[model samples]
Target: MSVSKLLSRIVAHSSDRIDTCKCVASSLHDHTYGITSDPLTQFACILSALIHDADHVGVPNTQLVKEETETAKRYKGKSVAEQNSVVLSWEMLLRPEYCDLRGAIAATDAEWTRLKQLVVNSVMATDIMDKDLKGLRNVRWEKAFSEQDPSEDAHVTTNRKATIVIEHLIQASDVAHTMQHWHVYRKWNQRLFEEMYKAYKEGRSEKDPSEFWYKGETGFFDFYIIPLAKKLKDCGVFGVASDEYLTYAIQNRREWEERGEAVVDEMIEKVKAVWEEEAETTDTFVDEASVSL
Candidate 1:
């Protein structure tokens, strides 16, 4: 699909999957950062979201690396998925069919280069596998928010602010489902668990995926999701949305604490049923193809 169309679909899907309150909260956050008014920054963020998982393989980078997949070898285990998504998306844009569209969007050579770099950097920033990126963001946050004078030389630079804001915007949106209503979060969480479980069953992952599913999710909320919402608030750009997300995340975590094991068991049953149905369908298709051949 064209980039614009893909982005539109993503927004629509998110609206359907996530609660309206959550969407409104995120919009308020964007408004606080003035993202809606800045065309270039806005475009970069939109592009990042559109291509963040353009051709995801339903597996994590850790699994790909463990299996020595071509992608892992190509990327040398560094942000494999993120880099692949950028490359694939860029390849689509560079195709002959997209020449006119590309030309219209990027009028000058420098503009095109800048646009490509922004998209790459923004997408790459989403790779949580890069430990240093989070550290840098934390350092920047402390300098910008913890100081008496944010304008001091030790604080975040204007360019750094632009980069980090865009990065955080895409990152937050990528996992927005986690901080939404319980139903919404539950649906996507199950899907992710199923994906990881598939990898584990295939012997690609290092650990028993099902064993720690509930505990891992709880820990994820405690260390990552909750902290992320707070960080957005701490940055002073998305306090309203951040607050809404933090509240929901806390509630969701509690709900999980009480019922997570049952939920995980239910999800496992659901995933098993779905997988069996899919296997049957695939087998039928293969038999039909063989007969025709």
Candidate 2:
């Protein structure tokens, strides 16, 4: 019923796609990430996905930081929304009302620690827009997957690889609409467009979304979405599913490249229509109240 619960459910489905591919799984990763062979690793990832977007205000961290909102101040302008979500979800989960539920989900102290840490890590990974975090993840990817460490212990190597891979997985699942069917991608894409458009309307943004919605979508496809889909494939865990995601991403990008203009126009018009209707309803209510007075 709650947004957190719904998101968690969706993430559960997405996390199920991961599995051990060409790389052999060590004992540590056997539960989740690539292996999908262990309950602790697997369920921790699911929980991470579940609460990653909890209590989101549908605003970018940059805006919150720029506006110096309370949440931004609380987190020192870093991952404002994300840190808030983690703290909120963690508090809710630790409440006495959820005691039995927590016990069922994480029966042991070690499992509880792993689950909590992974939840934090997975949710924090969603803040990829943060420059420092993005740079760190990029470096981790290269170092973990780089061709070196011939004498490195097998478990250590696998751990590094798995760590980065799971981070990638959570990130992929975060914006997964783009990697899904075109209609699904378009649906969320338009919703995001509307959200930003409203932000500008409500004075939370500087630029109008209509001015650059098409260009932005195309650019994101070229830069962010496609590359991320490639990473999903390169991770070598999802088998044919990775290829399917890439294919869908490419198709959606192509479709947007060709027809996004008309769609953006329709989206803007729909948003305007809703605003106009609301204005009229407010005017009618005011007239009735004045007459009553």
* Top candidate when judged by lDDT against the true structure: 2
Q: For candidate 2, lDDT tens digit of each residue in 1-293?
A: 12122222222233344466533334223423443555666676677777788888777999999999999999999988888988998899899999899878877898888777877777888898899989998887887766677888878877777677677777877888888888898898889987887889889999999999999889988998899889867766655666777899999999998899999999999988987998899999999999999
TM-score of every model?
0.79, 0.87
Model 1 spans > 4 angstroms off: 1-37, 147-156, 275-293
Model 1 clash count equals 0
Q: Write the per-residue lDDT of candidate 1 for residues 1-293, one digit (tens) a residue.
A: 22232223222212234458777556543433444345665677778888899889978887788889999999999889999999999999899999899877878888878888889888887887678777876786665456456455532354555566667667777787787889998988987888887877776676766789999998989998888877765555543566676788888999999999999999888878887998999999999999999
Error of 1 at 115 (Å): 1.8
Candidate 1 — what's its lDDT? 0.74
Give the C-alpha miss distance for residue 19 in model 1, angstroms: 34
